[model samples]
Target: MSQFDRQSFSLTGKVALITGGASGLGQNYAVALSLYGADVFVVSRTQKGWAETRQRVEENGQRIGFLEQDITAPDCAAAIVQHVIDHFGHLDILVNNAGMQLRNDVLDYQDADWRRVIDLNLNALYYLSHEAAMVMAAQGHGKIINIGSMQSYRAGKNIFPYTASKHAVWGLTKAYADALAPDNIQVNGIAPGYISTDMTRSLQEDPVRGPEIKAHIPSGDWGVPEQLMGPVVFLASQAADYVTGVMLPVDGGYLLR
Candidate 1:
């Protein structure tokens, strides 16, 4: 703690596996990790939109790998961890970023629709983390980063399941961090608020809600992917070896206002 070690923040020679990594914030996470010297592997439901992911990583002089499979698929937890180990010889980081949100009236929401959100957002994360934890436990070190949201702390108008799932995400992050601390694995989360992405286009473009959102944030604007790059790299590197069970908010002071 007395001396600064920039190398501790480097992810050189690490292997990272990211779920839903083909596009959006997930893609950004992959790119950022790779730029920090990790060989990134992406997993998602389809092979579409991977060209850009490959171009970005390779352009930065880092190798990239891909696997096409629904993260919610049965046994995906074990398969994905094994797939990464097989491809890179060992796994050092796992990013649980695959998730969905549905804006529906809670009173009229169907059970199937609710399950769809929970299955993908919460259950898949749990499964993947469990498998990755075991793999990391054996290796004596690893990093697991979960993507939570401002909703992980507060509920929205119609995203009932997303709110529930993200709150659970925060809980699971703590639980896993405590459970895996003995194995030298740090489990943490990033709770983003009003990030400018395709997923939040509707909300951002909403004439009525958009301004209200911008006005509410202390920064007075939506956050960009690049804004999250530093925290992501820090959490995944040796710099965060003693940091765990914590939810780091990347919000533009939205929670404060």
Candidate 2:
């Protein structure tokens, strides 16, 4: 095959499972993967949002399914992995993208809130990825993409838990990659910086803070969800088969400035 044909980023025969895929970045990852030819399974707690995501995926003429899962539950990881295998026959890509952010000063933060944030953002990912890695190990080749954040590197006021979770995510990515690379299962992360999602719309609309944030981004604009498509597709494709444990930042150079 020619280089172009051999290295095409098409996911024609792949089955992808994206956690928290009912909306936002997870939804974007689902759509982008389906558009690139992968059958997608989305896991989320909201049936309403999952239905919407399913509709969009179906409109693209790709197979799409969903598992209503409360990722915070202890058994949620095993159940989700089982659901994907039962429905899709095999799993080739796993995207751990579900997370939550709570903004409270370290001194004022509630213990419950901190536990909730860490449970969802860090613990759940660990459990889910552990289950998925077993499936990937059996298959001998698979991709595990963790969704990290700019907070992985810098501190943000009133968001201690989020920062801590992201930092842990980075470490998890490296550790998983080291353990799994020998088996040909690649683990990596994508750290998105200030993307313009509904979650961040309030920040964008804030007259006092919006412009200040934009000014720091060398791109002079917030990144759109679609801008993340390429990076995600690349990470999930054969092109990145030899790449693992690296955190690719899709932050529009916000990290630099």
Candidate 3:
């Protein structure tokens, strides 16, 4: 390994597109990348949290932009990438962080529900990645980060489609990495553990399920959104230039149990 330069972690002059930036981990991701010196473009279903996210990014003295639209719409990826390029003039990082989960037993899960989850979580990501990779290829280099989950490895009680989609995310990461490597674009994933987010708050509050889940984590606790900051900024920077096609778990050793 070559000597590590602290500057390798800087994202100065780069532009990043982060989906689902209206709230949760995506919001933090937008801010974190900007703090490292990257201009950011955020996309979400609504403008609910864009003002706050934009405020945070600008506070770091970085430029920020947002697009309010449902990512599940047809050709949305192409439109989003075009908007970013037209506004920013270039793109360097694509963070496929827009995801949704539906919790229900496999037997009770409806076809519509399954399709909805798959469309937003898996299909939309692939579409955006394909478009982003094209732009990145033209730029001669880029980084793509997919947000996976603990369910990417093991099955969850409910959320069958979510589990399936996340597992497929790992496959997508590898496939894209291989095909885009020659274009100088690196594709990877971050599999976060049971993070404390609005989606998981209910499960964490359940008396029985909550304790059982916590006991399984070797870290003896759940992770917060901020914990993902380092991993994302690392993958987005030069430090991970040689790394690709890997689904890195940010789980608190929950997979061990």
> What TM-score do all the candidates reach, one by one?
0.97, 0.96, 0.97
Error of 1 at 38 (Å): 0.1
Q: Which tens-of-lDDT digit does each residue in 174-240 have in candidate 1? A: 9999999999999999998889987789989999999999999998899998898889999999888
Candidate 3: the clashing residue pairs are none
Please report how far candidate 1 places residue 163 from its true position, in Å.
0.6
Kindly list the per-residue Cα lDDT of model 2 for residues 1-257, writing each as its tens digit: 13556447999989999988879888999999988899999888777587778888888789988887789987878889899999989999999999999987678899999999999999999998999999999988999999999998998779989999999999999999999998899899999988897889999999989999999999889999999888899999988888999999998899897
Error of 3 at 216 (Å): 0.4
Clashing pairs in model 1?
none
lDDT of candidate 3 at residue 86, scale 0 to 100: 89
Ranking by lDDT: 3, 1, 2
What are the per-residue Cα lDDT tens digits for candidate 3 across 105-124?
Answer: 76888999999999999999
Answer with 1 or 2, whichever has the higher lDDT: 1
Stretches of model 1 off by over 4 angstroms after superposition: 1-3
Report how far off residue 158 is in candidate 1 (Å).
1.3
What does the lDDT read for residue 215 in candidate 1? 95
Q: What TM-score does candidate 2 get on C-alpha atoms?
A: 0.96
Cα lDDT for residue 106, candidate 3 = 68
